[model samples]
Target: MSMPICIIVSPVQESADEAIEGRLHLVDSHDPQVPVTDLGVTRGDGIFEVIGVVHGRPLALDAHLRRLANSAAMLDLPALELEAIRAAVLKTIDLDEHREELSVKIVVTRGVEGTGVPICWVLSFQTDDHRAERAEGIKVVLLSRGYPHDIAARAPWLLTGAKTLSYAINKAALREAARRGADDVIFTSTDGYVLEGPSASLIMKFGQRIWTPSTAQGILRGTTQGAAFEVFGRLGFATAEVLVGVDQLAAADAMWLASSTRLLAPVRLLDEHDVPVDHDLTDTVNAALLDTAR
Candidate 1:
């Protein structure tokens, strides 16, 4: 038999049904009741946000909502009843109710209309990861699409800021990296400046400061990266938002990926090179990052 899509939510034995190409249906406390054949999801006409659930509360809830709101507005999609969605998220969290960190995702799809399929799944998943080795860091590959226009746009496009469910390109990029025997891909501009990782913001240190590409670089604004920046600055490290290349980062004292769930993980290797961590800087960055997440 062909392999079933791996979008299943393995939260303590909950079941999954295919909801869309890259998503699945799972039981929840307050899940939405959309039809399984809704074309919006079947056609990738949707938006989503993967939330970090801690202590039963989703971290950066406001930020996720803000991004979700932006994506929905851009897609000309209807406003998701926030109360209903929040309830579903919280309900899903209660399903497994584990002690370790978990992720809860919210997906909003445009219901099919006319020849289109009808609306569907506003759902959440309790994601469990045992890869604490990530605390050390992740190795990433920098691959440039020679301007990235084929797969992405900086046009006055709504999807640019929206967490749209149309992530086929994103998945492809990561696959390319895996093909190269790497864990993740760092997409660069035609000019060789970094944009972001396939699913994260870049956090590298140069001199005595922490730096990430600015929004002018045309990348998703990362909440965890930003929050950690504030905490990094308060802890006496200078922070910057600038465009630096693979080589520039290679010269940095340390590197890491910042996101809601990982908090911080050092990047011990870059490309084919083994980039060692400057122990002092790593400690400072780790302490600063985890403290803020707490």
Candidate 2:
């Protein structure tokens, strides 16, 4: 394992013409940095994006940055200098020696209480090995998200679409899955709509058609899912995003949890029921995803 590298970005929001390089400063990831009073620490008032680095390049970077901006806007934080953040991400990646497989995390906090400024940093670290999960797939249990499919429209304040730092619920769901003797969880809406995995986007395939849950259902838009769709499209598979029902899982020819770092892990078993796992197709999709550029 390699030590994580961090780069602090001062004045997260800067002019387009400003030199972003000078604003980025490399620091020890293990040392204290953020103030104890920061709202991200005190209230989890922040947003974050994780970008996977393959070989020496970052994958789906532009999409991840766009999502980060969306999250910040949803949180009512200051308009971020995306170019500056991009520079900091690249700098952090360059500073880290783990180039084979790494995950870059971009975090923007609401800053300390009483201070309106935002705190931002980019951290790059080696990713976990997901060979086993990707090859043999994972077992998952279906859990209720405790909200309806229309939650985003019903309560925008819930920040459903935003990838905020508050993830206690997601963690708890995974713990529940563990209690149920499952590897992961696929959260369903109270009204029986299939949502997504605790930390992944759910992808289901029915013959030639591939589908993922609609993002309007209060789920974060998935960057890796979009990339996977591209791969599926190239392979002559029609792709679409629609509202999926919990009962639809049993009818699917195959399903997988798509995420950064892990890439794609087929769901071999759902709620203890065996799910069809197309190892060959899974390998193809993952290979294309790993080969993705930018």
Candidate 3:
């Protein structure tokens, strides 16, 4: 079926019968609804993943699903109905009709009041500005994440490893960067360790070695970062996962923020100071990242 772009608040369970066709598609229905009581809505209790869709096919499907499952596990949500989620994503893409590059977002919430059943759905939309930024490069600023580097190990309940829907802080960080005339933010620990970006992973090139913020440092395990490192190794680059400092980023040969949709966007400036961006390395690494088909 078809419907205008609207948010449907479904008091009833979303069903396949409500599926629609358009520039956007909601996986089991045209409805974009969940009850106000849903933990995802009221308290931002949920896990989500955004995946790149190229030519109507989701890139690194299994890896994405694995991360989704891991996110859910970290949140202590129910075991994911993997096959169902997979079907929803594919169906959402198939129904979109336009096969241009897109982003598929999968979200699973921690159930509403009175019903332990989780809320899960897939939404597909046109790719965002990251596509252009990947080519033009971006300016970044280092901001404090306000946590010590080892907070994740010391306090597991912080959900540091999970990609939860509670992104108010992340968005605020980005907004603050914009206010400062910067394009994005690279978060640093309160104790002066480089963490990551608000929504992307940090990869810095120093001499012959490539480094990413360690997951042990309370950062999300960046799927794109891992994939890029594999590609980099194949391209004859040595890589490592380390605890980096904000000072190191300022002096790196080159740096980038990596994510599924953005792929890899080089940092040309940080904190209004110019980074010695290696254009050749940037282009080559970006090419390798794109060629990974992820």
Candidate 4:
């Protein structure tokens, strides 16, 4: 008897460019040949990064790659074939030149249970909801992460700052948020410090200044947030990394969830509290993000 193969094809965007569609690259993009013994599948022991593609060009590509490398290092994985991964990313984008907005995920699995080899692959697909969320904004609810702000520093084995595949809790948090009538979730530390969103970073505004939770507070360093901050600085906005609390969020001028795919999405409501949504600021931030991303 043969093992059943699962060939999953990524969905391309309808608004993508007309040139590249209805095509798949077997070796590069889609294949159902993962070894069942791979630790990534068995134990969720791996690292990954997702980059946003705009006009066939990946936004903040280098930054995302750097973060991927960092995650690999944190996991003590074998040396990454950076050049090969870069080539694969470019090839994936080339295969879908029509993708107006795409999300390319890079995954590096700690090979078959015992093998020293690592399985690295890139998967590209068109994103559907980022545009809508960015345009209309989103509602979020704060949930306790059940840990103190300094836990990451004390428990390095927890992999709190790494983008590992063990994201069951994060997904569960989002589902819980949806059940409560919110689109996303913001995790807070037990000590009452705001950490980050399940799949994005948190950014709050105070007048013309922007603030994000410090990485030292146990949040993943955000690539898109860093890029957006650079653009914000150019636009005459000050940026800082500090410990933010729910009370501070309530008093802020506006708040947003920033990520590689969504770029910058204004938070219109937080845990039923109406957050101040500055339309003009959102537009300006969005434009700057696009320009800087390109």
Q: Local distance difference test, per candidate?
A: 0.63, 0.91, 0.78, 0.79
How many backbone clashes does every candidate have? 7, 0, 0, 1
Query: Each candidate's TM vs. the true structure?
Result: 0.76, 0.97, 0.87, 0.89
Residue 4, candidate 4: how far off, in angstroms? 20
Per residue, candidate 2 scores C-alpha lDDT tens digits across 1-294 of 568999999745445566778888898889999999999999999999899998879999999999999999999998898888998888887878886678899999999998899999999877889999999999999999999999999999999989999999999999999999999999999999998987999999999999999999999899999999999999999999999888888899999999988999999999979999999999999999988753
lDDT of 4 by residue, 115-203 (tens): 77777667777665677788788999999999999988899889898999999999999999999999999999988899999999998
Q: What residue runs in model 2 are displaced by over 4 Å at the alpha carbon?
A: 14-17
Best by lDDT: 2
Model 1: ten consecutive residues of lowest lDDT: 3-12
| Candidate 1 per-residue lDDT over residues 148-207, each given as its tens digit | 432344564635545677888889998998898877777887776777776788888777
> Looking at candidate 2, what is the lDDT of residue 145?
94
Q: What is the lDDT of candidate 3?
A: 0.78
Cα misplacement distance, residue 167 of candidate 2 (Å): 0.7
Native-to-model Cα distance after best TM-score fit, residue 162 in candidate 2, in Å: 0.5
lDDT of 3 by residue, 57-166 (tens): 78777788888888888898877756566666776667675535677788788879667767776777677766567767798988988899999999989989789999
TM-score of model 4 (CA atoms):
0.89
Clashing residue pairs in candidate 4 (N, C-alpha, C atoms within 3 angstroms): 17-98
In candidate 4, what residue range of length 10 has the lowest lDDT sum?
2-11
